[model samples]
Target: MTEFLDALVAHAFLQKALIAGLLASIGCGLIGPFVVVKRIAFMAGGIAHAVLGGMGAALYFGFDPLAGALVAALVSAILMGMVHLVWQAQEDTLISALWAVGMAIGILFIAKTPGYQADLMSLLFGNILLVPDRALVWMIALDLVLALTIAACYRPFLALAFDAEFARLRGLPVTVFYLLLLCLVALTVVLLIQVVGLILVIALLTLPAATAGHYVRSLGTMILIATLLGAFFTTLGLALSFGPDLPAGPTMILLAAAAYILSASLSHGLKQRRARLQIRDG
Candidate 1:
């Protein structure tokens, strides 16, 4: 363990990756509950992919890709939120339309760019080992912001999630909460793109929360457990990346997926055993 730690910190890239992973996990842990409770995994996917368009456009236009992702995510979140407010009829259609349009724009922008096909693949699939110090700073700030804001608004958010109707009856601002949730999710998506890219970002965000839910009843415990799990996967994946030369993001996602599968199987067997015990007692 000491030897592995020594080798890992020997390189500056590994240090950046470790710091970035820690920051990313903080935000992912905080906002992951909303994704699970609101069941917005699909919407998260749409948002993640839509950022691709933003990034492609940014790269084409000679701006930082992070700027593009933030702008696109915020705009998409507001517009997507408004769609449900306006029609309340075809959310899936509208979200899907936005997603497709965003991806189309990304593709076109990438195609328009000259002499750069493989260059952007790092951003697309997450090259954690390539993360720069400036980007690492941004991740840390965003993680703190997400964590603090979530902690402040947690109760109302919980109220909104389980029973929005009741929350509304109590004169709580469901619309504001809903939009706030979407905005936070957008910020989180942008942060995650740096950690795992768009392809595996959703997996990292959702799987840890789900696996933690199997054993945790309270949201606080759930978030803590998920953070630990995310950190574990990130570290292990980095070690594996060192060995197999595989991309870190997908390796981490696969690790998280394995955890999910194991948790689910364990939960199922425990439930079955409990049922058997109940029957015997009866």
Candidate 2:
């Protein structure tokens, strides 16, 4: 294990990947509590896919893909948030349509581009082996912003998540807060596109938070557990990718899923044992 760690650090890419994972873990851990409680998984997924259009525009116009993706994601988020104000049938349907359109736009652009030889595998899944010091710095800045956002909006977000009625009754500007959450999530989705790509971004956002909620008694505890789990899974996926020849994004999702399964099994076993103990006592 020590030899492997040393080897990973020796390579600049692996080192940067690991560092970015840690930095991302911090933000995800902090913001994830609200994400889970608010039931915004689908919204997050929508934003993740919708970034494809921005990616297409960026590539077509001769700019960085990341810049384009960020633009696309932010726009998608605002559009999705507007769904509630527009009094639509269901926000879900609108989000689904938006997501498909974004994907279609991306495909169209990719098809039209001449001599397009991008390693689709890396962008579709993830290529941790490509993480660099520059990406690391950007990730750190993202985390810092997230930390501040959470610190400032904790109460408003918490109220909005568990009980919007109560928050609105308290004059909490529920609409503004809700939009802010989605916008932040969209930003997170954009950043994660580089780490895990659009395919598995939703999993990264939800799995740790979901799994952590099982054992943790308090919201704060749950966030800590989720953050730790996210970091662990990220590292485990990187290690697993060293073999299996699998892409980092899918591997990370698999690792997170495995953790969720483990947590569920343990919870089930404990429940069963408690039932047995009650029977014996009676």
Candidate 3:
């Protein structure tokens, strides 16, 4: 560990990865709790996958892939939100269809591209160490946007998450808020792709929040706990990956999954024990 810390301080790529992990953790911790509470985890996954269509088009057209991904993600998110508004019962089916179609479009475009795509695997599986300095700039900007937006509209989001109908009845512009939340999710997917890739982003987003849910009562507290857990997972995972030369994204996610399982099991066991003690006292 000491040697690894020494190397981390000595290396610039490692420094970037560390900063990237911390920023991504903070962003995911904040957004992920709302995602789980709102039951939009699947929709978030759909957007993550669908962004590939934009990436492929950008790759083929000699444009910025992240720009393409953001556009694609926003469009898909809006479409999904509209579908949910119009046909709530059929939204899942539509999301699944969109997910498949998006992936197909991306594959077709990539296949048609003439040159070899060296960064393709990194896009799919993620390589935090490969994150460019420019991309870090974008990530920091997006994190600021997300943080400010959440802070400004926290109450409306809380109402919407806990009870949309109530929020609507209270004249909170439910549709607008809901769509806005989805848009944020799109941005989050883009941001998190750096840390965990499109394929594993959802896990990083949810697991920390979910594990925090086991211990925290309020949404704010949950986000704080989740953020700390995310940082812990990311830092440890990156350090562990350094020795084995393994992919950091998957390593972080696997560690998060392990943490979630342990936290959940422990929470359940404690609850059961408390119930038994309560019965004995009675």
Candidate 4:
């Protein structure tokens, strides 16, 4: 721990990595609750994996990979939103197809690209230490966009998440809000890619929020708790991995998974105890 702190003070890369993680946590905290409540993790995962196709194509065409990811994420989210709206019965099948096709396209593009493709593995798994200054600026911009959008649409989004039919009856544009929510999810997925990469992004996105949900009944409180948990997990994982030279992305995910498990178990146990006491009292 001491060595980690000393090195943290000495390394600019470590500072950038820490800042990136915290910034990523903001998006995760904000979007993750909606994901958990709406049961849209699968859709979000599809959008996330689909980003690699954009990234790979961007590399091949000599464009910014992040730009490619943004485009792909938005497109996938929109398509998925439409499918959910029109073909609810076949939603999962279409999403799964998108997920597989996106990954395959990305792999093919990467394979055909000339040279070593040194950064490919990092994009797949993630290396937070490699986050550059420019990326941090982009993260900050994206975070602000997310915060403002959520602030403006909070009530509508809350209505969309729980009881969409009711929202529709209340004269809310449920379809527009629903699509908008998915677009936000797409953006959040892109933001998280830097912290945990494409493959493990879903775990980090959902786990912290899910853990928070175990304790909180209010959506607002859940987001607050999830955001804090995400910050703690990412920062501690980075520090712990620094000492052992472990892979930072996987380390952070493992920590989050463990936390979710512990929280779930405790919540379950408490529920059971409450039930038993109620029975005894009766």
Measure candidate 3: CA RMSD: 1.1
Candidate ordering by TM-score (highest first): 4, 3, 1, 2
Q: List the residue pairs that clash in candidate 2.
A: none
lDDT of 1 by residue, 15-129 (tens): 8898888788877888887788788887887888888889889989989888899889888888788886786789899899988898889888988988767866776788888
Candidate 2 Cα RMSD after full superposition onto the native fold (Å): 2.1
lDDT of 3 by residue, 1-282 (tens): 776699898999999999999989888988999998998999999999998899999889989888999899999999989988998899889999998898888878888887736667888889999888988998998889899999999999999999999899999999999999999999989999988889999999899999999988799998899899989999999999998789999999999999999999999999999999999998
Candidate 2: stretches off by over 4 Å: 271-282
What is the Å distance of residue 33 in model 3 from its true position? 0.3
Question: Which structure among the candidates has the greatest lDDT?
Answer: 4
In candidate 2, how many clashes are counted? Answer: 0
- Local distance difference test values of all predictions, in order: 0.85, 0.80, 0.91, 0.93
lDDT of 2 by residue, 19-111 (tens): 777776776687676678788888888888988888777777788777788788888988988986684678778889999999889877766
- Give the number of the best model, judged by TM-score: 4
Show pairs that collide, candidate 3: none
Give the C-alpha lDDT of model 4: 0.93
Worst lDDT 10-window in candidate 4: 111-120
| Cα lDDT of model 4 by residue, 1-282, tens digit | 999899999999999999999999999999999999999999999999999999999888888888999999999999999999999999999999998888888888888889727888898888899998888888998899999999999999999998999999999999999999999999999999998999999998899999999999899998999999999999999999999999999999999999999999999999999999999998
